[model samples]
Target: MINLNEVLKTLNDDKQQEFINYLDKKNKRKDAKNIQLVKLLLIDKYSSQEISEKIYGKQNKVALHALRKRLFQSLIDFTANTCIKEENSLDVKLIKYIIAARSFLQKEQIEVGYQILDKAKIIATEYQLFSILNEIYHTKIQYVHQYKTLNLEETICNFKENQQQLIQEDNLNIAYANIRKSLNEYQQKKTIIDIKKLIENTLKTQNISDLSLLSFKSLYQLLQITTISSSQKFDYYNLTSFATETYKIVENHTSKNKQLYYHIEILYLISNIFFRNKKFHQSLKYLQLMNFYMNENKQKYLKDFSSKHDLLLALNYNYIEKQEEAIQLLENSINKKSSNVIQNLDIYLTLIVCYFQHKNLTKAQNLLSKLYHTDKWYLEKAGLVWTIKKNLIDILLQIDSGHINLVESRLKSFKRNYFKHLKDIHQENVIAYLKLVEIYYKNPEKASSKEFYNRVETSFNFIDNKKEDIFMMSFFAWLKAKMTKQDVYLVTLELINS
Candidate 1:
């Protein structure tokens, strides 16, 4: 519905006039009623019923329905024609000429057909669209057979040469696409074992050395390997090391200004890796480099990048005990209009965490309410992070508000909806943390005692081997603070630094 409004809003005066002309020609008369109906419907708020009644009268229900259908078809046709006129690319023009040539051929307009074919051939050659060029050759051969034109030996040779080049290019493009597709799969699920298998199978079939000739694809594959390998092994030292080396490779090999976006992406990924590994200063450095590259390139439409960058920066701020700065950045970063934001769920979840950490229960509750009621909170089905974090935050909000009954109710719903899926120990830990809270709420003295801290420590023994579990990291820090009688923010920072 929003998309319909946007398309309608894009209808400029010229397009509207064109649509009017189209309707006039179709009707074969200066029918003012349909035109007026169209103009009324084009407005933001006007609807079918309003336009219908105005056109056919409220008594004529059947006629009004027919008129409304006509209006809808007219709008669709107008939009399509407008888009067709706006598409002025060389390939599109070439295809259009080919289509026109075929139409003329059907009418036995030989000269006009050849003229259109000539234009198409020129375009195909200029754009190196050899696939289309092959078609043009066959088409011209048809023209020759029909008209018995001059023998075209040279054109046949040209076709043969183009065919070989086209084959090689297609093969390389397919290989690149396969690698990119596998990389995309890894990114979506972040399962290193699956990606490793995919990559191994791809390597067995394709020459990795040849990939260097395909520079961008090569760089992307190398970057993916570096991150995925490090993540699979949980090796932060080499992750940071590989990230630095990859940054240099990008700077030295890729075109600076043209590949600015990819370069910034590499830096952002590296920074996030560092951030995940508790290397705040290193993460901050890479983030600074990302900003420097963007500044140097003077990139446009950075709202999406800005949103993610702010979220990361806010996270670093919160980790280093700059709660005010973190909260402010999080507050500023919420509900951005950028459709390309990569970490919207993370941003929202982080902001709520920051608010809760600050003990601002009212603001946290308000934000949670907004997120809960907002339609389609989880936009994709790739990860449990969004679901887990969302559930954790809701539980945290209720616990902070001292609403034991509401907390229990939310927990019941959470367990029912998500229990079967929570097979992993890390996932189960979230429920454990919530249950700990419930227990504490029931018996406040035990929560405030040293024995409570020991019990908390003993309870988290299962997480002992889980090094830097990103989802459970903050909760573990909060648990430590509860036991140590320290500030949660300070304890979180200490845990991160440690």
Candidate 2:
């Protein structure tokens, strides 16, 4: 029952209704209880005993458990079938052709089977479905004697080529997994891992060259790895060139319709990297392209990517001095119920930043208060870094609001909880920033003093503005604003421009 409830939570209201209708149609007996079970689960208001009494007019644990298992299986079948119908139409066609071909061949219908296999081969080859193509080639070789028109040597050569492609795909998958594992370890563990070096070594060890023939999905995964590495270092200049070059490669190698999801993902990655590098125009250009591609295929992935798309668009708008538009975008998104908890948290955090930048301290405080979940819950959902970011932002908000006692307590709690983790991640600058915030809270007059300004300047190792992380700069901008007595947003723009 618990497992079923969890799965049902993933469905939207419409999908839940669709699932209920599917259950209604699947029920063959008038006395079927699966539909009743689903309704009870959806309401989420009944105990097992209550549900059993409601459904069976008595507390029947064994019967209730059996009904729950049946409902779970039914849900799985419905979801799997729906996914196949929506996402894998082409693959399904190819599979049906292959199965039909095999059936005909087994029945000694040689000519019809060869014709069907030829059709399957063309579709498979065009989409670079190497595994399916391998099956097609194997089937051909098994009946090669029956079809003398098929040259045995040519069939063997094609089979071997498909095998090579399969090997490359396998190697890419392994390398991608290793890179993700390394990234996870670096994020979670108290250790230093050079992610960029690890990614480079993994690709090199796998013999994956820049011009290696790869499917659209493989290329997207490669870009994902690069994005992770660049994010760790707050460097996107190099990623800009790499992502564009990879985009060009994807265009040359894969069809847009067949790999639209990956194509859209790659576009978003490029735009985000450009945005990070402060190339607002370039980022918008890629975002436009992403939007255009997303609208194709009947907007198949629009819902899936809308939150991220809107988030990036809002960020770009915010940086380009379109604060009202940015705030509006985030405001519209933040109140909507979304299953994407992480993205929703990001929207909340970004909106809070916007509010803070506008000096709307009360609004920021109210929004921050709405994130009522425990830090541990957020840590599990959004990761430790994000949790720390929220804490730091909350502290800054309290400081700006002149809640001195609250700010002091928060600062102390932050240092106690995160000072060592920041140091472990080599983010001493964050620790420095927090200490300066404490100083500003304790002595507002000293914020503009030359001695304190020198302390601020010496505390952080400033890099090229183009390569600096934007969020880090935003925090730094607040400190600089205090020192220079300028608007923090304007200071932020000046810092980025510098």
The most accurate candidate by TM-score is 2
Model 2, span 1-498: residue lDDT tens: 357776887887888999999999999999999988888888988888999999999989999998888888888899989889988888889989999999999999999999999999988988888889999999999998888898899899989989988888888888889877766665654456787898888778877785538887888888998898877766777787888888788778756567888889989998999898889999999999999888988999887888889999999999999988999999988766567888999999999999999888899999999999987677667767688889999998988888888987888888888788778778899899989988888999999999998898899988877778877888888899989999988998888778
Tens digit of lDDT per residue, candidate 1, span 395-451? 767866888889778778777766554533224555667667767766765777877
* Candidate achieving the largest lDDT: 2
TM-score of each: 0.63, 0.94
Q: Rate the local accuracy (lDDT) of all candidates.
A: 0.65, 0.86
After best superposition, candidate 2 residue 178: deviation in angstroms? 2.6
Scored by Cα lDDT, where does model 1 land?
0.65
